[model samples]
Target: MRLIDSYRDKKTVDILLTQIGNINVKHKYRFMEVCGTHTMSISRFGLRTLLPENINLISGPGCPVCVTSQGEIDAIFDLVKNNDVIIATYGDLLKVPGSNGENLYMLRSIGFDVRVIYSPLDVISIAKNTGKEVVFLSIGFETTTPASAALVKQLVKENIKNVSLFVMNKTMPRVLDFIANQKEVMVDGFLCPGHVSAITGERLYEPLVKSGFACVISGFEPVDILMSVKLLMEQVNKGKFWVENNYGRVVKSNGNELAMKLMYEVFEDCDACWRGIGIIGKSGLKLRDNYKEYDAIERFNIFIDYDKSLPGCRCGDVLLGRINPTDCSFYGKRCTPDNPFGPCMVSNEGSCAAYYKFGG
Candidate 1:
């Protein structure tokens, strides 16, 4: 059988759902899926409707674009308006609204040089061809860090002076730690990010497990998610807070060592800002001193002060899993995808976008 078909097999999904249902637990269980892709998959498959009423799945600050602070969005806008450099970024970032109610997409329409790049390496070609300074807006968790690091490594080796990186890359474990310790959040188990797990491995979740949270490394497929839910439910009921690997086909105990080595070599831990959720200590990655010449923040003298939360926008609470998107007054009424007021509404991986598109 093909890989996708094997994971999406109806018989397999039914069997896993049955296994999950058989684990009769009386307690109200809340499992947080920490990967945005998992959130979309859960919604896309309508997996929540099939699960028992006691098993409540919530979304976390897993969407990179959604979690990117308003201050950073403001900084990006400032960088674009005040400078002559070309902005190369992934497409999702183009629509995320800044505090000034402007986005890269709007700026591009008004004649700013904003290019949607598929990969970080594309910046090298853009810089070389245009003979103009190019700033690559690097964003994502561990899954995309290695590529950005490689881009930096290449620029340094080639002595490319026109290219710089505006890095907004964040690490996952620290944020997970923050969520697990929050007294109000009520997360019993974490359906950990599968792609991030591929880079950092199972050992990365050991600390969370030790702190008394069930951590399951899950894939995005239907069977994968259902199987993860089953494992998480069993662990929670038995009071065994262990790290479980349900997606063993890709994830490993230690993760990809080469990728980890490359990532850390170019970037180091620093405090990062999350929209709605304040600053997290050592939760973000910044370019190392050796690569300071390629740092956009330093080159441009841009400093982000604080994020501005729009009135009546409960995106922050939604990201914390304190409330569902439906609880927000503006979710479907005013905050549709085409006319987004918050970052959560703009990114496809965002919880609000998932809830809006797939229906809770």
Candidate 2:
């Protein structure tokens, strides 16, 4: 079978769904796919409707913008207030509301010096040409860390000091461990993200599999997703749990070693707070001490006080996989995408956005 044609093949999807229906989960097993792309794919392909009724799939704290603490957003907004410094960030983070009624994009329009860039390379170019201080709002999972790390390495190679990184780089494994240990949310298996696994490899999720939860590194194709679900169901039925790689075409045991080396060379593990999930120890990547010259937080001396969310937003519960998007009373009413009440509603990878777009 041709690789390009395999994704759209109806027969393959039907066969996998049939196999999934045949498998009997000992009890109702709830599995969570802790990746935004996975959540988007699940909804876009109508994969949930094809699955067995006994199995439940929940969206976790996968969206980086959604999981980012309000304090961090406030911190960046604080940086924006500095006239000499230009704030550069991805587009998704523009609308994520902070403690007060301020966001990056809104601050930008008010002449706060915020700019959106597609990649960190743009920031490097901007810093090199302009005489102004540029702070790259480095936010994302493993897929994006390499680019940030690469930019840092570029700065080091050229001894550029004007460019800095205000990093909120999150590790997926640590956060997954936090979710696995949660008493309230019962996740029997995980459809591990394909892009993340491509960078970190299948070996990263071995601990979760050892703890009796199946982890399948999956691609975004419809067939890849359906096959992953079927594999998870097979593991559940036999009372066996293991880390499997369905996306063998890209992911490997070691992942991208060069990228990992670059990441370790430039960044150190530090504790970071999720918006609703509180702080998870050693789950975030900060600039290493040797690379302190590129640290925006230190350069700006910006102190951000801890701030909680507004009264009625259920983004915390929604992020932890405890409830669906519609479970919130303000889901569609007060929390539409145009005027988002929470980060989950604002981010494109957010469960609320996915549900709103796909009729969940």
Best by lDDT: 1
Query: How would you encode candidate 1's per-residue C-alpha lDDT over 1-360 as one tens digit per residue?
Result: 687999999999999888887787577889999899999999999999999898999999999998888888888998998989899999999999876677888999999999999999998888889878899999999999999999999998888999999989999988989999899998888999999999999888999889889999999999999999988988888888888998889998889999999999999999998877899999999999999999999999988766566677788898899999889999888888998888788898988888889977
Question: Which segments of candidate 2 are over 4 A away from where they belong?
Answer: none
Candidate 2 per-residue lDDT, tens place, 1-360, comes to: 787687869998888888777777456768898889888888888888777778788999989999988778877777777547888889998888877767776887877777889989898878878788988999998889989999999988888888999888898888899899998998889999988888998788988988888888888888998888788877877788888899999998889998888888888899888878888999999998888988888888978655656678888899999899999999999888888988889988999988888855
TM for every model, in the order presented, reads: 0.98, 0.96
After superposing candidate 1, which stretches have Cα over 4 Å from the reference?
none
Model 2: ten consecutive residues of lowest lDDT: 302-311
TM-score of 1: 0.98
Give the Cα lDDT of each candidate. Answer: 0.90, 0.86
Task: Report the C-alpha displacement of residue 110, candidate 2, in angstroms.
Answer: 2.5
Q: Local error of candidate 2 at 235, Å?
A: 1.1
